[model samples]
Target: MNISHLENQTFNPSTFLLTGFLGLEYAHRWISLPFCFIYMTVILGNCTILHVIRTDSSLHEPMYYFLAMLALTDLGLCLTTLPTVLGIFWFDAREIPFSACFTQLFFIHSLSLVESSVLLSMAFDRFVAICNPLRYGSILTTQRIVTMALAFAFRSFSLIVPLPLLLRRFHYCRTNVLSHSYCLHLEIMKLACSDIIVNHIYGLTVVAFTVGIDSLLIFLSYVFILKTVLSIASREERLKAFNTCVSHICAVLLFYVPMIGLSLIHRFGERAPHIVHILMSYVYLLAPPLMNPVVYSIKTKQIRQRILKKLCAVKLIQT
Candidate 1:
């Protein structure tokens, strides 16, 4: 455990080992099968969503545009860790180059931030559509949507860039073995031989400013949305308006609840079991991408009908 002796050594590791599941080494191959299925589901589901939105002219509004952006970010987030995860579990390919590790860390966290921003944007869309239906179209124009997309991308990228760069400046003289299948900011930071106070402060600051603020604003938007929905004179109209938001609410909860749980475990669960960390990480990473498409398909009538019609057309062609 004493890594201080390594400080004087000239040899620096250029690669790090990723231990997929510490206690389940014997069943790594079997474990990989389920992960493979999850990866396929995420990719295919998100791709289908994007294609449906693109081909259907009726779905060209700002809401669908934001959903499409969410799908894109989900795809990015899933793919960022899939390869390394499967590699470790299936082939025992655990050696990751230093640069590659940082690159993966950057994408995984940056895309997560982008997804949070997209959720916030979606919340705004709902607030406007329900609160000011008359001016929803005028307020969320195509140009404005495009600008918001650019801003989301820029904010995530700019905020996450310094993380990897700062990490590079440190010499990781400690053990280069990672607990999970992928590189994470805090996990890697813990291996540094130098003082990491600045890294910790910056990481917390970024999360507070980005995901923290996004979650808060999303809550506020929904509060306003609920108030507006309640003002409807007819019970049926209130139900219909509230129903429109159900899918987004589920998506937000799916994404944030596990994320918050994982953060809590990392900070407070000092003596928690290893399996707890692995399971929580899986929930945080896997659930959102897999559930988002399913939730939307089941909740949105237009998307559901479009999907069924396409399926029937394919069945007819085969027949």
Candidate 2:
């Protein structure tokens, strides 16, 4: 409505929350090269993993299907931040427009919610496989996988669509410069001139429902898995069960730890090292995408060998 008025009222934050990294003065420049390499590798690696799982008939089980969904969510997460983040570092346009900032915040969190849901689905799949091996095929059917995926998509949309729309009702006159590298909802909310009682309440409620409830469900699934493993009464069977879950366990820890850390810092330890804050965001968000394929390949020997065989086939075709 009032374009110029919005432009003039905003203060461009010179330093962001993650300003204290590798070297604060030239952190953006210094981190760019390595960050780009890792980011590219993550994208390519995830794409390859997804492609292999989708194309190879033998790899189309529920576990790998869930993994493909994980890769898709990871790609969405990276796409949300990569353009703006890289542009900020490589070019001069470090400031984001208000509309764009809110868009980024919405997608980032939406994809995050979707990723969490996918993980929950994977846990359930594992539980069914380990606890009721006979019924695994019947339980995790094609129609069921499609339903789980749709549920994840629907839940993410239902949860996050309200957030950005609600945020639009608030007027951010305090300062437009977001502290973090990207426009995080909480970080940006701190800049609002209007009373943010609604925003904070909505945020906490969503967190409690999605992250809190999903985490509890995941815990219950694992508890059942552990109990089933223990009942086997053979050390070999116990180790095998533990081994099957190691990758998912690693992924869950990587995701939830930094998430909890970020929430804590955002809530109480706002004064924590800026680099710590920044790195934690990437570790929490970026690392999950990067590690998902590696963890799955390492733990699920079939996918690992399939990946290796695919690579070998490519090499032979080239040679």
Candidate 3:
């Protein structure tokens, strides 16, 4: 199958987006250290959370299972972009090979989509557990959870597979300097010499189908949750329900708010500062992973206690 007309293009941008304030040209030293720190924290924190979820027997429920999946996705996400991003910052290799760039775009986008779907599933699980307590087990059975997880994976891969292939269809005739650290779809689309009408339409369509749909469903789930809480006769039950969801709500906002902002900024804030855009991108991608563990530990007593016990055990072993 013939793909992407490899006409052998070269890019000659004096400065990449990471280099400084867009084309304004600023020092790389300032951003590099901070970016490195963020990348390390994201990787290590998510890995720790993943390990906790895996080894803790009490956390075998649907909630923690989904949380582990979230950590896994975030880990993949960091691996997808951060290493190349750091390389670009630390080293000066702005020229990404066409094939490798497209592949990076594929995994990053696929994992992001999967994260959104998984969040939606988590919201649905919460709704069932809080609103229909008796049916929670039957509704979210182990088999059903596995099926949902598989569906999330399949959907993400299916949506993103088309993007790289579509990008591969085009010839690299013009600028190869990706504006952002990684090879995002929008950045590549902008670089294409041919008519990008199909690319834009297809990209927007998928975004709407995946991100938009998932976000809306999450909103609706919270709506039902709120209604159920309001109608409950016992104030204790209502408070418990609300408390249980606080962490998930925080995580959802951390994930989607920046995403929505980034989309809006990319679409509408064209004249805005490039630094602003770059900062927003980092927050959108990194903030969720950073906040997730904190949210869980703060809101879920069991997780908090388990983490504390582990900390104390380490201290005792040291002593």
**lDDT to native, each model:** 0.90, 0.80, 0.79
| lDDT of each residue in 43-157, candidate 2, tens digit only | 9989988888989999889988998998999889888888876775676355666678778888999999998898899899889999999999999999999998998899888
Over 159-261, each residue of candidate 1 has an lDDT whose tens digit, in order, gives 9999999999999766787667899898889888999999989999999999999999999998999888888899999999998999999999999999899
Report the number of the highest-TM-score candidate.
1
Question: Could you give the C-alpha RMSD of every candidate to the true structure, in order shown?
Answer: 3.0, 4.4, 5.0
Off by over 4 Å in 2: 1-27
Ranking of candidates on TM-score, top first: 1, 2, 3
Worst 10 residues of 1 by lDDT: 1-10
**lDDT of each residue in 208-267, candidate 3, tens digit only:** 999999999999999999999999999998898899899889989999999988888988
Q: Report lDDT (Cα) of residue 232, candidate 3.
A: 90
Highest lDDT scorer: 1
- Clashes (candidate 1): 0
Off by over 4 Å in 3: 1-26
**Ranking of predictions according to lDDT:** 1, 2, 3
